[model samples]
Target: MARKLPELKRRKPSIAEQQRFILICEGEKTEIAYFKALKAQYRSAQISIEYVAPAGVPITIMDKVKARMAELRREQRSNPSVKADTVWAVFDRDEHHKVTEAIAGRQVSGAQVAYSNPCFEVWLVLHHEDYHASDDHHQVQKRYQKLDRAYDPDGSKTPDCGFLMNRVEEAENRGERQCKSREDEGMPFGRPSTTVYNLTRAIRAAAEASRPKRS
Candidate 1:
């Protein structure tokens, strides 16, 4: 008598869980466009980036972020599947008051802040070179324009994502080094600096973590 052999079934590979980040931006067009470009460049099944543009000063922006965080909390309570792993308020110190207050509020709420001195354009400039000179919003715009001729000072143009994508790591490195230098010089909250690198670092980490492991 011959024994019948059983067929083996293969198990499906497991996918990494997705992480969601909610970014509350101060600029309606430029900031939104930049973050959207970043999201597209890092497209991954396990990472989600959402943007909210309230278009206001630092204090007002924080207010909107707090409200949104509350709404997210309520949704999460109703459905555990709905989650926001990180909440970030993106703003620049462009003649706006209450910058310190906004930073303090984020600390209390356990949220993050991607703050740039003069304007967000400073972060873009770091992609090309290390900029230590103090600049106002207008000056930083010119600096960015010089580095990226396609950059528009007005909010009409979208950033060149493809161009910026290749230089992101360089920008992060320059930004971190500048910040560290400032901190060491007893000017922890000095101008000509940005914390936008922190946000981008988190995004990269989340995307990397979501990638499947190979045996």
Candidate 2:
């Protein structure tokens, strides 16, 4: 018999890289808080959400995002392998002149915008029922209260991201319908429209997809 058999080398399994996301929002409270809750809900180590400082206006928010991104690039000089899959700026058009500028400005840094015309509340209201009005910030809240009885009219109460997330699909479909209607009316990305659902869906899907499959 052959004395010594050659030892076989075992192959190492491939480990997929984590999906990286950098989210910058105009609102310090709602957008930031909502995204934070969303990230926690997934509880996936394969997904990363970078935090940027709170900004008030759309242009200012874009400024902060670009600054942070510049910092990241400098960091890459040392790390040499750091990369971000997506960098998104979430903002609303609430009579702010800079909103349009900010959305168009994303081309400079290659960042994407999850824009909601009129206000972010449009996206939030969609979670409850169908809304196609180009309502201002206040009206959006009123509509949201109809769905969420616990909603507080005063500034004291915070957003209900958990409740909204539970019906994310419904909200997403409604938002799509609104956008489609706007587009058909020659007003794409105009009032009564929101692209927040696009960002949410991508985050949820990518977070789940990056995880290793279990037998």
Candidate 3:
């Protein structure tokens, strides 16, 4: 009889664990909708995107973010997996007086700020074209609508995610270029600039990490 081969142990395939990201937004509808759409587009088994829209000024939104961060920390003590890998405070510099305070609060709370000057619509406008002019929320919104007729034509203030999602890479590139231009002009936090691309970059990184690896 042929000798039986020794039994070999099979190694188990590792399952990817989901990374948790918590985002607190100042806008009740538009920002929330945009981020939700982003989460849907980059849906993955190994990534979790959560949003909290406090619908307030930058300082108030930062307060909510701090509270949520505290709650998550407490939860992590019992279950470490519940810990959030990153927390972001999303807000616009729309003539808000406490914008500086809110930005400073991030250092103490260890949360990142995805701030847009004039308004969040500045980011939306970047998806279609490069904008460097100083404009308020109204102007930016009008420009966005002009660029994409399908966006908020009914005054709903909701983003057209279908049109926006496909152009994320283009927006990111344009935003980064504008940021560089601003820095070169010695106005790092100038109007018509947005750090929203930084937040999106983080989201994309998490999604990429969640992708399955081929043997």
Question: How close is every model to the real structure, measured as TM-score?
Answer: 0.88, 0.84, 0.86
List candidate 2 segments past 4 Å from native.
Answer: 1-15, 45-55
- Which tens-of-lDDT digit does each residue in 11-117 have in candidate 3? 56554676677787777667877888888888862333445443678888888878877877788887976635577888889878989899999998888899999
Q: Which residue pairs of candidate 2 clash?
A: none
For each candidate in turn, give its C-alpha RMSD to the true structure in angstroms.
Answer: 2.6, 3.8, 3.0
Output the TM-score of candidate 1: 0.88
Error of 1 at 29 (Å): 2.3
For candidate 1, give the lDDT of residue 209. 76
Per-residue lDDT tens digits for candidate 2, residues 1-215, read: 87998888765545467757777777656676677778777665343444445447788878877886787777878887765557788888887886778888889977878899888778878887788776777888788777766666576566778766678878888988999999999999888899988888887787677665643
Where does candidate 1 stray beyond 4 Å? 1-12, 45-54, 81-84
Which pairs of residues have clashing backbones in candidate 3?
none
Per-residue lDDT value at 44 in model 1: 64
Query: What's the lDDT of the predicted structure labeled candidate 3?
Result: 0.80
lDDT of each: 0.81, 0.76, 0.80
